[model samples]
Target: MGKPVLIIISGHPATGKTTFGKMISEELKIPLVSPDGIKEILWDNIGWKHDFTEWSNVGKVSFELMYYFIETCLAQGKSLVAEAHFHPEINNARLNALKDKYGCKLLQVHCKADKSVIEERFRQRMASDNFHPGHRHGIVEVYGEEKFYDKLGKGEKLLNIDGEVYEVDTTNAENIDSNKVLEFIKSNL
Candidate 1:
């Protein structure tokens, strides 16, 4: 058996993290744990409000659930891919601790795109009917354009951790080759 691997798909919002992470998870045959996925479930079951505070609280719960799932998988010696807009100050320590405790190989795939492209993508997603209402309310209605973009601009870097980092240019998501990403993971693991 090989070492358990934790593939972290991280970046600012609307950088194609979810789409790319899904590809990695499918190719690697590992579970994909994402906060937004959990949050959607929580919204469906427990309900959500259009207010910022309610959205923020639900988001925190989603992260907690995501970490619980990650810890459980690692404890069982299973590999998984976790996708999120992870902040260094909030998530780096916890992720590093998990890596050390479980002796898992950590690989961070940080997606990047031009600011303008990201902004446009985010706007489109927010406007889409399929997008979760909680997100549209929290990000667009509450945070507004300026604050949201400012936060996104600040989070364009990787988490502070000891790991193999692979950066993907997602300015054009169609240009991303999943096979190459899988090759990188295979070589690292």
Candidate 2:
């Protein structure tokens, strides 16, 4: 009986964005919008990374589907929990445009852990995810927070889109618990 919410989770790969998004979505009883999972679904239907250069349409197709999926979710008057890097300008632009067009609110969560912690987590996750058909070992996963900070330096948009953001760095003693993230989300909502 409340207005719909659009909660977007954005961060670098292997930063546990999806996991956190899933948790928050379940906690808030909102539907989730997962672009990465979409990639997995369409993996066999399109080109893999090795073929990225050859078939530019592959990326376009993925984006288009993601767009449609978000639109559908919003039209249903349901809140959404979306996970993605969103470091890319293109993705930001798309979300910004869609926000205006659909009148959807966006809650951006930047999940952080120490660089070393992320790398170790990446190695652990890669043991399984690397074998996933659409996955490969990316340098960002190996570098973690360092790579994220570097991207921020290189001018990736750390947008407070819709003026809502929940920043969490597990390295900090204060954020050692997920309560910080939940509190931020509650305040924003």
Q: In candidate 1, which residue ranges exceed 4 Å CA deviation? A: none
Please report, as a residue range, the 10-residue window in candidate 1 with the lowest summed lDDT.
149-158
Candidate 1 TM-score versus the reference: 0.93
**Whole-model lDDT, model 1:** 0.85
Cα lDDT tens digits for candidate 1, 1-189? 387889999898888899888998888789999999999888888776657777788889899999999999999999999999998888889999998999998899988898889888888887899998877767767768678877664543688877898888889877988777778887888
Candidate 2 lDDT tens digits, 15-129: 6687788888888887776756776667666545544343345446656776787788878776677776665556767777767877777778877666666566656665674
Best by lDDT: 1
Query: lDDT values of the candidates?
Result: 0.85, 0.64
Error of 2 at 107 (Å): 1.0
Quote model 2's TM-score. Answer: 0.75
C-alpha RMSD of candidate 2: 4.5
